[model samples]
Target: MKVKAILIGAIGIILLFGILLTPKLKTVLKTTPSDEFIQLMYDGDVRELTQEQLKQYKDDINQELIKLKHRQSFEKIYLSLGKIASLEEGYEDSNNYLLNVISPGSHTNKMIDLKVYETLAVNYIAMGDIEKGYFYFNEANNVAYQLQDAELVASFYQLFSETLLNYTNHTNFPIYLLGEAVELTNDYYKKIQLRKQLASVYELNGFFDLALTEFIRALDMSVEKGYVDLEIKILGRLSLSYYSNQRYQDSIEVINRYFELSSDDPDLFYVSLWLHNHYYLYGYESVQEQLKSLEEATSNLSIEQKHQLSIFIDFNQVFFLHSDGQYEECERYIRKLEKLKTKTTISELTGLLIDKMKLDLDYDRGDQGIDYIKEYRKLLSDLQLTNDSVERKRLIIDNVLHHLLELGDYETVYQYTADLQKPVTQEITIINSIMNMIQNSSDSHYLAKNNITSMLLKLGSYVLSTLAGVGLTYGAYRYNSYFKMLKRKAKESTIFDPLTKTLTKEALYETLELEIELGQNELYYFLLIDVNDLSSYNESFGYLAGNKVLIEISNLLKIYFPNAYISRHYGQHFIVVIKKPNEEELLQLITSLINEISNNEKISAKRPITCCIGVSKGYLTNTLDIDEQIKLATKKLQISKQRGTGSCTL
Candidate 1:
């Protein structure tokens, strides 16, 4: 019922946005008058061109250039020549040729001159002369404004922005231009696309906060415009933005939302990626089964799409083969991928993964893996690597750590760990920090609560996915704190906690990961409840009284969320994972849970028992984004705690 309402609501939103965008969508869809033909003379389409079409265009433009040169030389001829030249990466040639149209002795066509400036800007940016590119872009904008050609200006802005992207991620200038373009054009479809570009630029620059805002706004506009295809595209890009940033959990969460909205045959390659994240987070043990299933499901993809999808498929093969003791097969696939890596424009994230696989599979040659560390780091410096590249790098470093530890090279290992890499050792350190902070219920501890919660959620994700090998490296931990954690883990090995009688933290995450891996097509609501002021209860009543409050809340949780998975997440924090078809039903349930906890006589002491609840919901996306959702809920709980006695937050 909740999912149905959401679908209906989503449909309504699309209809409303479409109605709002009718005028603007019409504008872009409508053909330009002869006056605008001058603009069309430059470039007819703003969309990505296929190789065949580009080849044909290059041929056609060259023929036109020859014809114009034979007859009478004209500004359009130079523009045509320049356009063809630029396509061949002949930036300098294109620049010199384009300058012919604007040269003192040549034609004085204002529109042609504006186009020349825009083209030159694109060329210069592609050539790495960003400052020069901006200068020409400004010139083009000025000419566009003088002509009062909003459509022309908009197209130019979009073109230059796309061009600049290849050159740099510092997108402030393009952002300014795109903002101007969006404001100038009433073309809602174009506006959404432009906003997506703007958001992407923000993301590439690591301004995820800004990127998220723009992405959400664009998503709303896409839905409002009734552009389901566009909405799907927006969601896909937004997920990539998150994935490229190493917010895999968030990436999975967005993908789940994508699943809820996307069609049956949504983008095949990203679907594969979504599956990959699903398995990585959830079904760590079911690689062969999942891989075989995905291969069958995606067999219908085009050869090109399959080529792209192979990265995920092949990587899993290497991983699964290694695990299954098919060492020769695993080594063969790894070698094949190493060759594949050279031929493909693999993203840094994928590159790191390939290298990390090498480290994992070739533990005997760990030092060789360390040698490649500089190259990966160079990728980081070049910004080709995603933010999560650091984590991937850490995994490689861990492999190196194992090799060095065997050689008894403690000094070198110490040197390597001294840097900012959050290797397995660092994860242990973080766990230590969180455990320590949990005991201290002071103001500062609560202040640290939000960060700790996020890290713990992340740690929970690593517990299965990437944590396997890291688990081995933990043998090097000589600290007593490490042993204490091991003892605690040993004692709390069951699926349910011994006290308060709910799913243990590890078990809750495991269940969430598995649910995501199963790719359940149901809306899920994650509610993170932090029992407020536990120390106060302990202080006022007694330790047993505090225990009774926790126990009673746990029981009430089962009664209230009968169909939900309830878990105790260590120290005053409890997690409730439930599926409700409609959002209203979830909200009502939250309200009831809050009231029940506050009113139950068994739970109440000097004052009614209170808890801060943070909630997040989406259809089960196979994203194993449960961790991200939990993180969000935890953040909301912290916000509630910070906001002072709030019943709940979303």
Candidate 2:
């Protein structure tokens, strides 16, 4: 699952960069979109999408726009169309795209609304309208941060950060988001890529020491994992990072290793950079000789590579000519470099050199512009440049389908995304309830048949306590220790949440079963409540903090629905069955519950709390299957969770 999540993240981010980040195409994809990917894109069954289809997505947008011109209504495909328009349309014309993104009838659908808010935010940031960007980004991020899946929320942070990379003055924001992304992923390669991305952002702003740390870490992991291809490029960037920090000797040594490992195909940009940096150490003549050879080296290069290389060569020549006391030639070369910037977009970091260049050939803000990231474009290429393997191709196809469709599939979105959850078993919950009754109650006769099991559990607890007393050392666990506390809870016929003291699944089922057996007709509203990313709460705070959240939710349940039957249904879910006086009263209760959850002193003081609830109401009868009703309510919960934007009821 960890590997799969990373794969999904990599594929989704890469595809997103192609479509949403760049807006304009950079390199033409070597591999075509898989037939499966294309079909999924058009069929709208896909929840993820591949970069290969981005060109198609772009072309289709224009085609769809042409088609929409004649049509009276076109809300079904509005999300995709609006996404591209929000980007392609400049900030001055943003209102039209905003209108297109948020059609009047589209406000009810939270998922679509989320995508709209996110796109508006990203587009505004890219356009340097930071005020509007901050507004929408906070709105969208709040919605996404409240999603139930930790992976999806992490994915969104990365997506937002990566989008900010191409253009935006939000420096620390990308670093923070990428750091969040790095911690969330488990895949070695993905971590390396994310770190490189984080390092690249640092490099962009002259944070060479910080960039070096990440680069070295990525290098170590790449070598340990035998990813020679990635290691070779990291060496080139490390050389530049060293030079940026005035470690000239170290830079030369790293550059030597870069060449040694690179063998026949050295990176052209770094090759030119090396010449300028090592002018004194390698001798003016030796550097001059290498510069002559550099022109012949590009004979076999592509047009785009040649364009980017030409800029790199001119950039270095500006500095070299300046050092040689050839001020006039240096000025001419600087002018030439400025013209080269408009030719192609492949330089990545070198594209910034001209912007920061001064009349004296020095860079502004103390940032050595020429020393910024060269590995960034290559890093993304190594990670997402190709989709060669059949399995990987399918992974890209499926993941991309869902990522794009995350705007909302109203019907199947929950089924696709929610399937990633690591659910708590009802058996374990029942056992917790069972042990609670045995431990808290006076009589042991009801469960005396399970004496041996009870004895073993007691012995295990004693052993764990003894070990803790002895101060046993262990690494931090990835998940919460909630399960470890389950044995301490109470109940038999009535199952209870171990921490919250609310009912559990078994107790709710038993209650409904008894009601049906007694032949009672009742009018009740069933609400399924779920907290978003509860494990994150555990990981961020402690297990105790997470328990507090569950307890607080239970408290809110009692406050809002005092007459209702409330249960902490398994994991982060809560179930509440109540007899409502009227629709208006139920709405008020739900609104208050959501408001309290968000602003509560106990739960939201440290981290803002958010939840999604699914409400189902009907007249219950002896003939009606309660399980079916529960299933319907659960399905509604899934819907609300998927269409997340604070606590929602469907």
Candidate 3:
């Protein structure tokens, strides 16, 4: 019994020693900050880290950030880890480290600055804080501008514009910004990208003329650059834009062009297949042949590619099948997309949303279609995702309008028409009032002359009759002219820039105001801009060039605050009323605008451009009498300029 007890004690002591000294046991009990960090990074790289592991790693690094004397090394490791965290969608951890751990001054490194800003911008975008997202995007652009790297600058604009385009009100702004980017960069590939983005923006804003221009430009650029992938993508956009504009022949032509260009590449070929399917659904004569071709082409693709293609092809197939009265096939395709939706990543959701909507439409379930669209919108809203995808909302709106019109729901249509007619009605009232005043003054003068004639007694009747006849004729002519003017004004106000017909600033402003009024109050803010360099721009660029600059600035303002109210307040000055903007976001926006204007070779290459901005709390009142506010804002803006270039006040 004594021998057995001794053996047990020895075995137990050995086990205890192993627990104390083993590498795994030591790692668990006595892990150094560096060891844990390295391990965390490894786990992240290998995709084995849990949310708790990520949180702990972030905490450890943040603590190390305070104690580390060698900040240069610390920043590198910290940013490196943050990048990994960002990839894993640990946005909170990544943002905390980027925003809090690293010194702002340490962001002097261009690459690091780019990464940090991009990550932060994306995070803010993910959180549905577009104001902050744009702010960081502008920060990223500033860094790229500092580097004098045109490609990077173009890329930043592309990303920023894309984010802005996700919101309906901000769609036009991205197009304008992308145009600026196109002017700045000489690289064919970058130019193609800018054009593609511009096309998407224009399409979203219902600017078919501009959309077509951009799509053609992109196609040309892609051809020039020999980028088949880009060519295919642009072709797809072109087809959609054409389809939206009801240019069915042009849509078919572009889709065919895409099919030809992508014939050699399977991925591109699959895209072509999708385009062909859409073309068929849009009522092209050659759709049957195209469908046959699509099936044959898709058959040769790998299982994964086929599955991916089905995600798009199947959805489109549902539309075509439904149109052809093949309800069973449509249901099958709907089920396929429904199953695919379960496994889709957030990036794929937009496309999936589109597919689901088509399925709903094909099933003869208009209510279901509308419901799906609303759900899709909510998903986008929740994810804070923005891009060309949001343009789908316009289609949904059109669909709803069509359904209402079909059901002879005139009350609903009238309500929509009233909403559409409000701006026109306002303009007409103003113009008619001015015309009435002129007519009344003329009538009074004629009456005074007639009274003088009546004093003569004999010619009184003749004079009165002559005067009445002339007045009636003139009034009739004036009435007709006023109607014509109203029509002209309505068209101009909706489509043309008030200052320059190249674009419509008023339309842009009204759209912004509508967005603010329509959106959830807690989510938006405004930034009122007043330009300081219009005179300089006009003087240097010649009057035409000056007009171009005004157009360019208007376009830039549109891009920078797509979801915000942007308008030409007066001569060489503008106002942007944003939604739910914080102070830091306002500063970032001001800084970006300043940098963009100052760095733009088109505007600033020959002479520098400067702007002073004021940030207000929320959407400005339509009745608030903008004259005094603008003057005050302009005066404050001048003070900021006197202080230095690129200054702003709130």
How many collisions per candidate? 8, 15, 16
Show model 2 residue runs off by greater than 4 Å.
1-55, 58-76, 86-111, 203-207, 226-229, 256-266, 293-315, 326-358, 361-650
Candidate 2 RMSD to the real structure: 32.0
Residue-by-residue lDDT tens digits, candidate 2, 1-650: 99999999999999887677453344322222232332342333333444445547757655655655433324335555555444454444544555565666544345555666776776776666666666676676545533333344455556667765555323444665677677766667777878877887777545667899999999999999998888887888788778767787788888888899987878766776577577856766677677778778667989878876777677777767777766677778877777766754534334443443432343222223332223222222332333232222322334332322321222232332232121112112322433344466444552343332344246534433432332122111111111112212213214765568788788877887787678666777888888888898899987768877888889888888888888887778888887645878787878888888999889898789898888887766643556666777888878887787465664
lDDT of each: 0.66, 0.60, 0.58
Error of 2 at 406 (Å): 53
In the range 1-650, model 3's lDDT, one tens digit per residue, is 99999999999999999987898776455644645554443232323557786667667766766766654656555665665577576778878777753465653467667756866876777556756766676566555544655555555556556655453234433544476578666677767877787777656545568778878977887888789888888887787777767676677677778768776653544455455545555554455566668678669879888877666666567666677766776677777667655676635545545554553454364332144334433443433343444455555545554444333343443444334333223223322332333334434443343322123234434333432443233221112223334445557666555554433455655564565476544443444565665776577656656666677787877777776656665567666655566668767877888889878887666677777776445334552423445555666676777777677776
- Measured against the true structure, the TM-scores of the candidates, in listed sequence, are 0.47, 0.41, 0.44
- List model 1 lDDT by residue over 472-564, tens digit each: 343222222233343444445467676677999888777777876786667778888888889988998877678778888898889888888
Please tell me which model should have the higher TM-score, number 1 or number 3.
1
State which candidate, 2 or 3, has the greater lDDT: 2
Q: Against the true structure, whose TM-score is highest?
A: 1
Candidate 3 global lDDT: 0.58
Off by over 4 Å in 1: 1-73, 241-268, 280-283, 286-288, 296-311, 317-332, 339-650
